[model samples]
Structure formats: structure tokens, C-alpha cells
Target: MRTRQSVCARKARYASAAVALDAAKVAGLALRPYRCDRCWQFHLTSRTKGKWMPITSLYS
Candidate 1:
């Protein structure tokens, strides 16, 4: 059972959440690493509200 969401399918996929988070960190943007249900991979999103945000110096 493999069905990739259109929004996620066309986007980059990270093998792990750490990798995704690191990529975001390098980008120097406050991005949230979330596990995609459709792709079963990690993806970054800018939507921070109601989402877990890392209490790091970059975010702070």
C-alpha cells in the first residue's frame, strides 16, 4: 500500500526526521519536521502553529 500525496509526492523526502531537521537548519528557516503519512518519510513545513517547535537558539 503506497500512495504518495500530491503535495508530498512532488516534494523532497528525507529518510529520517533528523536529516530533515538538519536540512531546515542549514536553510536557516524555522521549519517543522513532520513525518508524512502518505510517503512514510520526513518533510519540512513552515506551518508552526499547533506544531512542535524546537526550542533552539535559531528558533528563539
Candidate 2:
């Protein structure tokens, strides 16, 4: 079932993670599927790698 989180994020909901991954590939977006705790539905998100820095770092 589709969830409100999907609607809010403007992303399509898939029946399974595999389906979502397929869709992401078809769309040419490097995305990873993850289940939302709030909605309990699979959603696609871009895979990013970075370290969290303090807000003050931006100005320094």
C-alpha cells in the first residue's frame, strides 16, 4: 500500500525493495531502496557518502 510519506516525498511506492531498485535503474537514478519506519513502505533514496560535520565548520 502507498503511504503518506511517499506522497509527501513525491516518490513512487513499490511493493518490494527489489522493484524499487529496478525502477530507480530504469529512471537512471543512483538510488537505494529503504523501508520507512513511519510509513512502513519502500522508498528510493540517493546513496550518498559523507561525514557529518558541525554547523560551525561551514563558516570556518
Best by lDDT: 1
* Most accurate candidate by TM-score: 1
Worst 10 residues of 2 by lDDT: 1-10
Tens-digit lDDT track of model 2 for 1-60: 334654536766787999997998898865777787656678887744563445764574
Give the number of colliding residue pairs in candidate 2. Answer: 0
lDDT for residue 56 in candidate 2, whole number 0-100 = 69
Q: Show how many residue pairs clash in every candidate, following the order shown.
A: 0, 0
TM-score: model 1 vs. ground truth: 0.76
Please list the C-alpha lDDT of all candidates, in the order they appear.
0.80, 0.70
Task: Quantify how close model 1 is to the true structure by its C-alpha RMSD in Å.
Answer: 3.8
**In candidate 1, how many Å is residue 24 off?**
0.3
For model 1, how does the per-residue alpha-carbon lDDT over 1-60 read when each residue is reduced to its tens digit? Answer: 234578887878999999998999999987878888887888888876776555684448
Model 2 stretches astray by more than 4 angstroms: 1-9, 50-60
Q: TM-score for every candidate vs. truth?
A: 0.76, 0.59
